[model samples]
Target chain A: MINQIRADMYRLTHSWGFYITLGLVVAYSFLITKSKSVGGIMVNGNQDALTRLSRENWTALDGIRGTTMSSSVLMYVLIGLFVIIIGYEFSQQTYKNTLISGISRFQFITAKYVMLLISILITIAAYFATVIAVSLILGRHVGTSWAHLMSTTGITTIAVAFFISIVFSIAILTLIVTNSVVISSILIVIFPLAVATIHIFADWNWLKYIDFFGVSNDVSLGKLTISQFGPYLLTCAIILVVCIGVSLLTIREKEL
Target chain B: MTETILDFNNVSKKFGRFQALDSVSFEIKRGDVYGLIGENGAGKTTIMKLITKLSPLRHGSISLFGETTGHYQQALKRTGAMIESPAAFGNLTVDQNLKVIAKQNGIQSKNAIDDAISFVGLEKKRKTKAKHLSLGQRQRLGLAFAILPHPDFLILDEPINGLDPSGIIEIRKLLYKLNHERQTTILISSHILSELYQVSTKFGFIHHGKFIKQLTKAELDKEKQSGIRLEVNDVAKAAEVLDNAKIKPFSVSNNHSIFVQTNQLDTGKLSQLLIMNGVELNGMTKQEGSLEQYYTTLLKQTDEGEK
Candidate 1:
């Protein structure tokens, strides 16, 4: 197991795609945090809109962690990054040679997931750092209670929300469903946009809660609750479980 | 003579309607250089995938080093291969590629990495990017990767597929050296039978994913279906002489020369009888079999299916 993990990480890490992704994200984080042009989002600043964003996340490092765990966190970089790591294996024809390396499909699949997980944690952490640094610099200049700006519950809520969101779950799903990177990336990205539209215009408000795009408004991260299955929350739960189930099933049976 | 390094029983793999391998069976003993040959779509790669557990067996069991399919890591880890392409990150150097593979297989020491590099004659190109290397160089790097862990059961599918002549020679030399020095049992395939013929001690001719025949060099050399050659004045008269003499299974080429099937025929007797029958007699001698001829014969037999 250790051997397989070592090999898988080596293969993924040595890839130019992996490093290029980290570099790009790091660059993005730096730019997003430092850029002075927040010509600003059209805010109805409706207590509801602020409530939604506020409930989704809280950060000590406003410039870094806040942006790090932003609802778009997974979508911005991880979608492309995960595809390069996992989806490329089957699409690029590299997996043909890799299979004969004397490793089983299960080990390979699990190792790949682990690598993605570690990548997510590390990159998000970097993004969080930028937020924190900016928050500190601005807090000193602007005179705000940076410490009281967030509750522990707020941070944990954001982490778990991102975890349960479509990024990791759908990335693994696409790994099994399509097996090809380019197709998977397009499908994964496009499905959410279409769903987001449905959630806005169609009667499928049920779907926002289902799995593709239901995010909580005021869930406490530090106060992690044993999820009470509401319709929206239930949809999220079912889809997340089903997607992971499908991923494992395909990995177990699908041809390498 | 040694332990069974690999075995397959009635393995069949199907890709939708097209069957890649059909009921293939073979056993490879330890330390043997086993050569596999077949035309395109003959299922050579499929069988290699089965043995290495790259792809699961569809209808049969494949055991490596005596372990069954379900728990193949130990057995598979003992095996190595360069199935299709020797692909790697375009930016990684040859040594880096070897090290990564070595580490992946649980080999931590740098000495093993260096040893693998030297084994493929790529020691000089260690610092060169694998993508920058020529096709032959990539082939060498692949060979180096396969052997880096010192695996006992090695499978190389068309390992020399894209090599220049010099590259082919170097790979062949490396294979020969491996078999001699490390006694690693190898199963390598090539559509060009001649390439496989060089280093393989035994040959298995496969067609449409079925095992046609397994022949040793000694058996091929001795039986001599391609045994004798003769120059005859009259091809028809020579045919009649051969018929009358009950010398069966000889081929008469367009040049009017006959290739007799066995060494037991008396060339002098054949010539005299043809001359007596008012046929011209020119010359006669023995023939050695080429790998291509043997392969064609085996494939033809499989095509005929004992009919």
Candidate 2:
């Protein structure tokens, strides 16, 4: 398993798609910070139409955490990463080479999951660093202390990392089952919307507990208490386990 | 007393309502180039998949290197395969593609990769991407990947699929070299039976997922009809001399050859008789049956038995 993971890392580093997607994630962070500083998104030629906060009152930590919180937008980047990491193998049928090289289905899928986790960590770090660099260069006020900013941004990074993991786990499971990147990407994009749509139609308070995307929105990392964060973590854990489990099972039965 | 490299015992497979492999069983021993002969959709690839565990085995047992108990990971470590089409990352260069496999196999030596590339005659194309390669080059790339690990056993399905005549001969020699030098046991399937005949030491005939026959090259040679073929100076005179010698069922195939379908023919007696009768005998030898004819005849018998 370790060797498989090592080989995958070598492939990942060599892949143009990985570097391109990482660059996109960083570029997106810069764009988001720049746009947020310019008052907000333009709506019908009005620059302040969606302006809810003033940049003068925001801190560098806020800039970084704010970009991380928009994991909804970041999910698409994760999809691209997943496509490169997992989808390409299935499409090219190259996974058979790995398996026939003595790697088991369990090790193969586990290695891919680990690689996804690594990519999420790297993307999170890059996104955070980009937001910070852009904020400093754009002359945003340091409204918070460095210690406070680091702690809060650290917490938000973890939360966002957890969120991306849950999202890409679904992508991994779907990719393994269907062996189609397009289909897996569709499901990845549609899953949050589907969950949100279901909650809207049912109007059930209990749905919020399962609506990870909705709950993720309310996660103001530094402000949340233990009781509030525990359930989210638990839900993320359950979903990750289920996705990993199902992926392993289905891959074994898949006629490669 | 040779070691068994692979064994399929009463293995069967079904895809929904379609039966792909039906209680099929065969064995490949050490140093044996086992040719798996079957028509299209005759479960050749299915059997390859089963042996490699690409498709899960539901009915019977498959022992690789005498380990049938577990997932065969340890046993598979010493095995290499290129089943179906040659699969590779189109974006990666041939060297990089092979490097990925080398990494997976924990082979830290770059020499192994170079050796495989040169062995498959892809030394000049090592830097070319697999997608940019010709079909024959891709086939060679697949072979290079399979042999990279220096495996004790190899399972190749149509490994010569896209090769030209010379390329086919090169791969054939490569297989022979692998068997002779490395003692690599092989289970190969190809539509080209004559090529298979040139290399394989043993053979398994399959039809409709059933193992119809399993025989060695020598057994196959004996099973096939053999007859004496004589290249004479005068075909008509040879026919007359053979006729006077009470040699029934002799034929003048062309202007200079007479085919005698008799295993009991006295060559010395015939040569003397033909010489005395003014028929110059150039050469005389026994001709073995062709793989195509034997395969066709076997399929016919199998179909008749089914009916």
Candidate 3:
């Protein structure tokens, strides 16, 4: 298992796509920091909007939230990265090489998952660093209490982790089912867009609670209450588990 | 008694509506260079895939080194294979690609990788990306991957598909060395019957997903039909003389040549008899059936049977 992971990591790190994707994520974060918007909603420099909100100060928590929220679109980049990494195994038939070398199917899948988790953690860290660097360069000030700052960062971290997990799981499941990088990436993009479109046209308020786009929006706006966050986290967790479970089952039965 | 290295027991496979393999059974004994010959879509690759567990076995069992394929990792640990085509990461250099495989198989020594590269004659191209390699070079890399870790059994499907004549000879020599020097059992498939003829100790002929026949080298050589040809001044007189001697000619050609099929016919006695019968013998040659002719005859027989 450790050998498999090492092999995957070597492949990933040696791939130029990994560095390119990381560069794009950092560039996107920098753009979001400069724009002062979370997905194009003006979160800074709008005194009336800030005063209307409960918190009037532009704190580091807001900076982190803005970066994470804007970088949600980086999910596409993440999916594309994994598509190149994992999809190439099937496309080039390298998976058969691994199998012939005595690596089990279960070990193959577990190694990929381990690599994905590591990539997610690296992406999160890159986003945080970009946000901190940009905020410091722009002389942005934090005026919130330390307790509040820590609590808000903790919640935002959890929300980002949940969202990233969902996207990662979806990427993995799509790659497994389709086995074509282009098709898997197309579906990954379409799934979120389809959900957002339905949420917009549907008149039901409950749609926002179950929609991933809605959840991201709520988290970005800092409007998520304990009640709303709990159910959203639970739903995302379930989707993640199901995607992983289905992938494992499908891969076991999959013909090379 | 030689131990069986690989045994397929009544294996059958289906892909949707097409049956790829039908009750195919064969065995490879230790240190034997087994050749699998078949036409396109003849289930050669399917059988290899089943042994490697690239495709799951649904209706039959495959045993490698006496262990069922259910314990494939343990069984495959002593096996190496290059199926269909050479599989390598296009983005990685040859050395890196080999390193990845070595790490996967838990070989920590760099010398092993170096030795494989040298053995395949790819030492100079080790730093080149796999995508940049010519087809023959990639094939060498695939062989390098298969031979690494010194497996007891090596399964190769068309291992020399894209090689030039010298490249083919190189691979043939390498496989021979591995089999004879290292006592490695090899199961190989190739369309080039002539090349297979040079190294294989046994042969298995498959047609339409069936194991039509399997024969040892000696059995095959014995089964092959041979004939004696005579170039004489007068074919008619030679035929008459052969008839008089109760030795019928199998064929009498327009070029004054007669062919006789009989292992017991002595050339010296025939020449003496022809000379005594006043028939001038210009030249006589004995022709042995080649592997190609043997394979064609086998296929023809199978086709006739189907008809």
Report, for all candidates in order, the number of backbone clashes. Answer: 12, 0, 0
lDDT of 2 by residue, B114-231 (tens): 9999999999999998999999999999999899999999999999998999999999999999999998999899999999999999999999989999999999987765578999
Worst 10 residues of 2 chain A by lDDT: A40-49
Q: List pairs with backbone clashes in candidate 2.
A: none
Give the winner by DockQ: 1 or 2: 2
Every candidate's DockQ is: 0.43, 0.68, 0.73
Residue A118 lDDT in model 1? 65
Question: Which 10-residue window in model 3 chain B sums to the lowest lDDT?
Answer: B248-257
Candidate 2, residue B67: the lDDT equals 91
Question: After best superposition, candidate 1 residue A122: deviation in angstroms?
Answer: 1.0
Docking class of 3: medium
Arrange candidates by DockQ, highest first: which order? 3, 2, 1
- Give the Å error, residue A4, model 1: 3.9
Chain A TM per prediction: 0.68, 0.87, 0.80
Residue B121 displacement in candidate 1 (angstroms): 1.6
lDDT of 1 by residue, B43-64 (tens): 8887876676556566988888
TM-scores for every predicted model: 0.84, 0.87, 0.87
